[model samples]
Target: MPPLIDHTTHFIAGRWSAPDTATFPDRNPFTDEVVAQVAAGTRQHAQAAIDAAHAAFPAWAAMPPGQRQRLFLAAADIVERRAEDFVRLLAAETGTASGFARFQIRWSVDLLRQAAGWGYRPAGDVLRSDTPGRFAMAVRKPLGVVAGFAPWNGAFCLAWRTVVLPMAFGNTMVLKPSEEAPLSAGLVLAEVLEEAGFPAGTFNVVTHGPGDAGPIADAFFESPHVRSINFTGSSATGRMLAERAGRALKRIVLELGGYNPLLVLDDADLDLAVNTTAFGAFFHQGQICMNTRKVLVDRSIADAFVEKLAAKTRSLPMGDPAAPGTVIGPLINDRALAQVRQRVDEAVALGARVVTGGRANGRVYEPTILVDVPATAPVSCEETFGPVLIVQPVDNPEQAMSEALATPYGLCAGILTRDAQRGLALAERFDCGMVHINGATMAGEPAMPNGGVKDSGWGRSGHYAIEDFTEVRLTTLTQGALQYPV
Candidate 1:
């Protein structure tokens, strides 16, 4: 039987509100079956949600930090208690494996707890001025109404960063989730928020069809009441959002595309390198924004690494994402599957060899590995965003960093080296946002700063989140009135 999921309304102003527009079907990627019908919100609905958030801002932001902290954790606890249902829906709608779905939900809960800690954190710093009797200080203030656009993959994490952070920082938010896999996670959180005693207008959600992004984008970008926009998606969309939001002088935080590289040094541990780096490529079927796409192995170890990596890739269970012990899940949709196959086919045409799996059955693409891929091949250079790994041989550490930097994206990179000093040095030159030594690029450390540079988009995660959602106000006062120089 199909997993039960019946969310068909927008969670607006702390209520289950129906959309004015027609609804769309949320289909299971693997089964190609309709799980539920989801409401498709329009520009008018987005504006209404923003208006509600605008109305709720003052009261919500004025509430005590401690109160906000308590409410956030309360909502988080609610979600945690019902993890089983969430995990099932997550797997069903988003094509996330049962284990990964659980991880995504668990990680979101953990991130919520981490966000709650920031409620009590210091808002700003007091400064000592050079001039006598001068009092100077910079304080953080909430951006009144924040508009958040989250993608389908990892809806929980994106929702927490995009909406929950704004609420935790005392601001109100209007979140618009991707229509394909939007309902369950967003609706659950909204219900949890209401049950946790949040105000009616404190947080709102607007779901729309994937084809309906233009109207929603226009709504958020053109709205004067929306103080900022937080987006996590493709570079094309992020650039569009940045350009539109910049014209209106609204703050923008984008976590965009990533063609992350994983380098295996000649002296690295073969077992550790193959296992961890394969995890990076195959995790979430490489749908993660921070997944490792290019695997650069030293000439001394390239053949050995490929042998082990191929065996590991062949071992990954592919089929129903909801099944136990399955790691390789379906692509989010057909286009995603095509993109993966196109990369592999193109690489093969250009003389790259497929080490193991290289075919797709509907949305399920086998975990594939291609060897002898040149640096310029599309598979190695482009963001495949699938469970496909392209391994290239590098002469040395210098060559590895040079090739990794050649890509237009700079989100995350993985370096596998037993030498601590060498790994740190290479990390400094990788030109990406985060680097994990001897680990996969898929790890998201909530306690530490995250995000990327270059085309990967600006802004950081974690503590940088507060700055993204809040504005810093500086004020300096003198004890007495000073004479005018003019």
Candidate 2:
């Protein structure tokens, strides 16, 4: 094996190991500098990690919950002490603003702490039994050898969140982090797990350089030992994985593509609406799965809303994430940059008007706004994972609601209005799983249920996350024998 570069190593069976395949430089999206050399991990590497997890599962599950809790708390402390370092690592690797990077670290740490506390809680329910002298209940048990896929977008937050809950519930996981942003999987969570004294193989990482995730993912589906799968990525990719999971009879969770919508009503506070919508559309350079892809605004207030949004977007700084006040950073890689440019160009050709800021400078694209874009345009319907906002005018509340729910992808939806009652009513009509009432459509807390319906996500976050990581086990105890079957 060749000499591994900094930030390049896989954590398997509790130790850092070298990759078997060739390595590639994982570049910083902003300056195109090689932040780390990542391993182009193969299916064998993936299976080896899975094998380790499978070997470790019985011991991990048998360990006392309090012991597990204490270890997790130790891990949380270690992470909190050096939280700023991980924040910097996240921004450099993923082109996220420093503030957002801090948010990711803070949330991830909180999630770990929260997972630790789950030890005190019961995993399932005790139910009443009809038979005399019988006890019946359902308990949640760890699903052995989980396979996790973390996408490039929100790598820091999603990657750690995926593994934390599973590990907390005593399930061993092998994570296949995205090649574009894989360092955090090893440097942050894996390091914490090792330091906190997790037994060998409790947590594992398999990172591949660009275009190498497919084989590893396939191996995950093919492996009978992998009892559960957790994936976060594009809907197109999620479908293929879901199919494989079905064939393999493995439990699966997929958080996929989204065309989330933000509705700005005539009654909304214009300033707040503009700021929220702008942030929703452009935060992390619009790389989020929950970004506001389509904005359905009341025609009476749409003009002013769009104008103010454009102005606010212009004020957001776009450059090196290390610099102070750089709100907008570069896209993940060349493919993302080119996709944004192509979508905007195609939308313009479809008669949309670029209000301002349509320039793409290498990996960095300025936060942009498009007006008069047809509601049915490709950019309007598709997930344009870029810092561009497409605005469509609607005549009334009914039209706005109709337009917002028309998309095939239903991850998240929101409405801005002063009437709390009406806002609640309107929000309930959204086809998506999550509804935001004057809230930032793109934002979610660690404590909230983070997954979506339709193409947004199959499994959930928060309390439900534990349920997904566990399989139900029902135990019935009876004295003597009950009556024969009915």
Candidate 3:
């Protein structure tokens, strides 16, 4: 492994500088080793970041949208140039499969390019004139500074979607990358922005623990200069940020948690459906918010599909993350590993049988499958965020749909069926924000909106992520008002 570089300086006001206090260490999950250290942005440091963004907002926002677009496009090209290394680092630091990491890099590059194009489109519409000598028109204006907080899973794309896209639309941003996966963000972004020739302070990356983030969030919420907040994380955390931002009258975009389900109807293509469900549920060791957790199969085909899924899941390779043949890697950290164990244990204690794999070796939990899972089990209700699948038998498509939507969370879900109508109908009735019929619930084109409903989350990200971070100030220009106007 390459020696990790130290990012102990907070990137603020265009350059990096050491903070006033202690530094934070980033550990490699695979080896249980400390690979690098990052600057701990204290309350003062967080305030400094907000202040720098606040100061830079006017200049950044005032720049022509085309210039911003060019800058983002350049950055996108730079990312593409270094795609292989980016994927390697992502796999190294994030414990993500190399293939999935590569996909993320490719997807993120495309997303950035698409977001750059959105900068050129007209943002506001012209209003109709009421009468003669009266004309009406409207123009859209950029919001002020935006604060984006992104999580570790798919961090590169999530962070890019949260910040760069919005910044392309003329919003200055103070971005807080997840401490767990800080390197790829800062290193890659630095290279990209340098290639793009963005103005200093237009985008800044601050590395710190969660404690440093709260003050930054609060500062953005309270300050008049900061107009919006974009966050991607758990539902509980999203709710907290939304509430706080609401109190401060700030616009917010939240892409939160998901306990996704895959409904297998009686008319489903069993081979294709089982394979799709396996990847949808087991990929990235089920770290994705959209990864399928529950498999609701029609009782008629339940046994067959379950047997097939179990057999395939049993064959998933669990070993070194860098190995070409490895399918499942270790959990991100001890905390996540413990959480997976607890959830599995709680479900089994509640009568959910372990169908195949359920045990853990250090941070590596075997790709687990559960059957006869009580709807009331912890794994059933909560987003397990691990490689665990619960198989349930439903009497019909309606019952499967009901079981799928029984939980309050609805981020993403997949339906596998040969009957096109049944799959489409099931997709419509399902409560998730993103629904897949024949395909698995994997990352799609960045231009398509992505987010969830219910406790899963509110608002959307990707193509529309910029919309959440900016306010639409409709400038209505009128020559004169009606004679009767007060």
Candidate 4:
């Protein structure tokens, strides 16, 4: 067993405040062993974090952009140096398999490096003026005191994503990480920033127990110091937060749930399709928001595709996340396990064919594939955050696209076809925010616009996030005054 981690204090104003008497246990999902004791902060702590960020905003934002860039670069180096420790921490806190943990680390490093370049980009642009001898320009300025909520599924990567870009654009942030992964998703980030010599109160973190987020959220929504908010989590939670943010008249960016789809055309490479589907449906046990949930295959290739995918799913290794060979690990908790079981069992009872797995072995639910699932089944329409895939046959490409657009989610979609032109044409028709040709739905790049539409939520991440975190102000100077009609 690894040594237990103890971080039972809120990080406020660049220092770790005294430990909170009320604490919560963070457990290893596979073994149910307590991995760390995290502080359970109250509304007061949340307010203090916001206040600290507000106080530090002007100086931090006023600093030279090049100096800020260097700090982010140094933080990236620190994270890279502590890679092994972070791998273990993720496994212990969130049951993240070695491959996924490493992927998170790699992307986080990339994100930091990418964010460092933002300082060099033009913050605004010159505008044409119709009046003679007039100069006009539009400039971007950071919003003050951004409030961020990070989810646990992609703990390390999402936590970095939630705050890094905004901070890079001269904004200070107060983060509230998921209780289930406070150390991996919250304090570890604080440690890196501290080691990199970030200014005091430039970033703050407040953690709460599972059912205790209400107070913290209330504080974030009600505080006048909080100018904007960002969240990565379920759609249900995002809706609640959006309502509060709207009432408070604050701007918000949300990356919520997704019932992503993957289309397999008849002319697709069968080998590549099967390989991509298996990875997309089962990676990290399908807990990712981008995980493929529905697969629409041309009727002629449906049987062959299902057979190959089921075999591949069954062959995946599942066990302790600490093992490098394990591909599928335990769900976050009993509730997640129960939810998967209930959805799979309910679908089976409703006459869906279970092509491969439909049972649980302790905390690990086996990778499951269902064919001919009824449209009315909850698993067919709802976002099931587990290792489950629903397959359906479509007669033509039009029907396939129709089925893909039938959902409330518009996060992302994938198309597998031999004809790149046809794939691109179809990609253009997708109402979602992102589409990939001959690729899996689980694809992402740090420089690309990452976000969704409709019920999947609005706003984008990566290079595009700056637009949401900053305000545009137009300025004009005239050489001579002109007569005005009053």
Error of 2 at 347 (Å): 0.9
Task: List the lowest-lDDT window of 10 residues for candidate 3.
Answer: 469-478
Model 2 / residue 357 / CA error / Å: 1.3
Candidate 3 on 270-322: residue-level lDDT in tens?
89987898889888889989888888888898899989999999998987777
User: What CA root-mean-square deviation does each model show from the true structure?
Assistant: 1.6, 2.4, 2.0, 1.3
Give lDDT tens digits, candidate 2, residues 178-256: 8888887555678777778989898888888776677888888888889999888999888888888888888998888
RMSD of 2: 2.4
lDDT of 1 at 140: 93
lDDT (10s digit) by residue, model 1, range 169-284: 88898888887667654665676778888889899988888688788778888888989888889998899889988799999998999999899999899999989988898888
Per-model TM against the reference: 0.96, 0.95, 0.95, 0.98
Clashing pairs in 1: none
Q: By descending TM-score, how would the candidates be arranged?
A: 4, 1, 2, 3
* Regions more than 4 Å wrong, model 1: 1-6, 19-21, 130-132
Instruction: Count the clashes in each prediction.
Output: 0, 0, 0, 0
- What is the Cα-based TM-score of model 3? 0.95
lDDT string, candidate 4, 1-486, tens digits: 656344557899998988645888888999998887788899999999999999999998898988998999999999899999999999888989999999999999999999988977788999999998899999999999999999999999999999897998999999999988898889989989989999999999999998999999999999999999999999999998899989999999999999999999989999999999988888999999999999999999999988888888899999999998999999999999999999998998999999998888888889999997999899998999999999999999999999999999999999999999999999999999999888899898777899999889999988898889999999999999877897
- For candidate 2, report its TM-score: 0.95
Q: Where does candidate 4 stray beyond 4 Å?
A: 1-6
Root-mean-square deviation of Cα positions for candidate 1 versus the true structure, in angstroms: 1.6
